[model samples]
Target: MGITIKDIAKAAGVSYSTVSKALNDSPLVKKETKQKILRVADEMGYQPNIAAKKLVSNESRTIGVVWPTVERVALTTLAAKINAALEQQKYHMLLSINPTKTAVDLFNRFQVDGVLVFGEEAHEEIISSSIPLLYYGEPGPATYPTIDVNRRKAIQLGVRHLVQLGHSRIAYIGDLNPQHSNQREKATGYTLGMEEAGYSHLHEAVDSRGLSWQAGYQAVKQLLSKKKPTALISASYDLTVGIIRGIKELHLTIPQDISLVSYDHIPEMEKLDVPVTAVGTPVQTIATEITNHLLQLASGKKVPPAILDVELFQRQSSRSPE
Candidate 1:
């Protein structure tokens, strides 16, 4: 017993075609007539059947976000950023936390205009999907377009910056799993930067094992117990929060005791007890780029893979070793 366009047309004393044009805001319908029709439609409690609408227009005007989990802090922030950008383009963003393959299948069933995948781990196992896809991390299966920050360059530059400040004993703390491509790139950057600076013997990389805040805090505590590094570079914002906690618990102060540099650019870094020096593309910049790529793929356009460079933002957390 749901209200239909015919009912609205009859109630508004107009033909069915005229009612349809007014409801869709077609330019052929006068503004006042459209407004009156809209009012009548609202009063009649008519809800749109999205599936039917999609069948007619061939576009859902929705973008599905396939995120592995909502537990990751950085992922949530980036999702919000992408959502805002999509809204501006009159596209709705929907999120799914299902496994990569499952999420893709679900989005396909829903018939979203496009799918944006966040890379947390290697997705080589994902099967080919017919829908347009744009990845925000490493390129996965199906040869879709991918855009990522240059993680290796970001970490390498962090190490070089610390070395230039006369700190030979700079340690890097992050995930050391070989299967995680992004973290491996960072680990490699730390080693390469050390070798390039002639400080390979003094280089130490602590394994965080996971990306949790607790992992960062415990990694640093164990690292401090065995080695004495004048400077430490923690990878990821969550880990940096834990690193600072571990340092403070030991009655040490940043710069005066141990200088630090983190490997992510976010506003939260500045709000910490000691504002952090960071290296990477700003979150806003990455978000905007990914949004644009997602829209392009949705329109059946191809975008070549992109690797964004990094920049260092010096702050209160790092200084010369005195």
Candidate 2:
């Protein structure tokens, strides 16, 4: 049998109740006593009975992350960051790739402290949930507290920056699918930014269809076929990479030939051949905000839905178009 709290209490010369409070890090236990008990517990190889603790506290101390589109590379990175943040708080993170409804039900049955849903799609179908629910993208019609990055503002920042660099002919490339609200927001921002700059006719310059690297390459190829824009705004990091590859294939140079700006803010963008200027919330910020909000919900605290702001990080890729 494994070493239990009672065994540790005996070894530390404390009551069983005192050992329990110390193990739980309760304030009722003196700091010195708690430290000694923990040390003794470690030396004795004492193991906690999680099942019993859950029964007593009525909490699993676990957060369920319901992400239907696990294949999305950006979401995968965000999830890893969130997992690390939760681990630091002594909370476990459980991931489910199941459909939204199914994942909600599963998490409800498992009685997790809270559920963080990853996308806006199919959120309308989730009419109700027994557990606290926090959404990570567009809130849609759900009543749950939602947290979303300002996708539209991110694109606008890129467009405004390019315009300020004296680039009248600017193009945005990304997935313009109406089904994806996030992409739609970015596309709308591109149009709005152009209109705001008194270049409303340039709204047609939004070349969008897919979110992949090939899509960005093909879109740039097609755009170049007609008339090469002075500057290009890619809707995503992967798309930016593909756009760069396409530019090289056409024997063109960035900034000198065609300035570039990307949508998502990621570390990899800075490490590219030419560090990319990007506009979006940093992954660490997004993860930290989401994790902190989820913890608040788990604690039965009220948290208003949040639309996190994005910022522009200028780097080597952008310059005045010659």
Candidate 3:
């Protein structure tokens, strides 16, 4: 279907072996012949077969990313950042949105230099493979290398920021399923943060039931109808969007009627109708850390488990109760 070495040989009027030697720049081929064959190959737009090159060099210079869930917008930024970071190191990235095992198997079949799994849920497991694998998100296997963000601490920081602004009555909105480990971490942080602030009696939470924008919007509308908190912390970016929409529909204003803080510190937060105060290590920093560890893994260098810290970024969406 595409240009092939055989086609280039015919165009150059050379024997198959002669074309092969010239293409490889073999010393047996005369310099003029090699150049002529190379020129012909270039004219024909011949492209090297990755599989064939792997047989000779044993390195594909490719990284496969396993992204089982495609609906998560917050992670899109992180994935793109990682892609750019990998390109800086002369590595190409491939993404698979299939199930964990199937994606890993495909990457293994392709013989990519490594695999990075973008884990979303808790209690994740993978089949043992000869290829190096790394996880980002919730805890994976004990022996598996991972890049974990301190999500619980991220929420705690959000709570701390609101409490410092003199808001004792605060609420949290997010998925509360005990089985969902990522959401569980944020929920725990809210509890611990309230207790640490000595406002355990004022602690409140509304389960969004899901992480979608619609879920957040509905959850906030329901929560606000029953009770009014001076401030609210959201568990996700998508939920933050829904929360803002819900607040506006209720004729309430951010930081005037209610203040808000969100979980993800992504660029989109700034572009929202009301800029959001967010919690987490910036995706750029997370991206760089992930890229460095991936390179290390590809080089056969063992990487220790990493847990990145999250911090609060104060912005227009959160302030002292008015």
Best by lDDT: 3
lDDT of each: 0.89, 0.86, 0.90
Best candidate per TM-score, number?
1
Write down the TM-score for model 2. Answer: 0.85
How do all models score by TM-score? 0.92, 0.85, 0.88
Which segments of model 3 are wrong by more than 4 Å? Answer: 4-47, 123-126
Give the root-mean-square deviation of each candidate in angstroms: 2.3, 3.1, 3.3
Which ten-residue region of model 3 has the weakest summed lDDT? 120-129
lDDT of 1 by residue, 42-116 (tens): 999997766777999988889999987766677777888888988999888888989889999999999998998
- Name the TM-score of candidate 3: 0.88
Instruction: State the lDDT at 283 in candidate 3.
Output: 90
lDDT tens digits, residues 1-322, model 3? Answer: 7877888888989987898899877999999989999998988889877777689889888899998566777888889999999999978999999888888899999999999987777645556768888988866677779897899999999999999999999999999998888789999999999999999998899999989899999999999989989999999999999999999999999878999999998998999999999999999999999999988998889999899988888889999888
Candidate with the larger lDDT of 1 and 3: 3
lDDT tens digits by residue: candidate 2, 1-322: 7888889988999999999899889999999999999999999878776556779898888999988665455677888999999999989999998888898899988889999988746355744787889988857445688899999999899989998999888888888778788888988999999988998886655455766778888888888878878899898887887889889899999979999999878777888789999899999999999999999999999899899999999998999977
Error of 2 at 154 (Å): 1.5
TM-score ranking from best candidate downward:
1, 3, 2
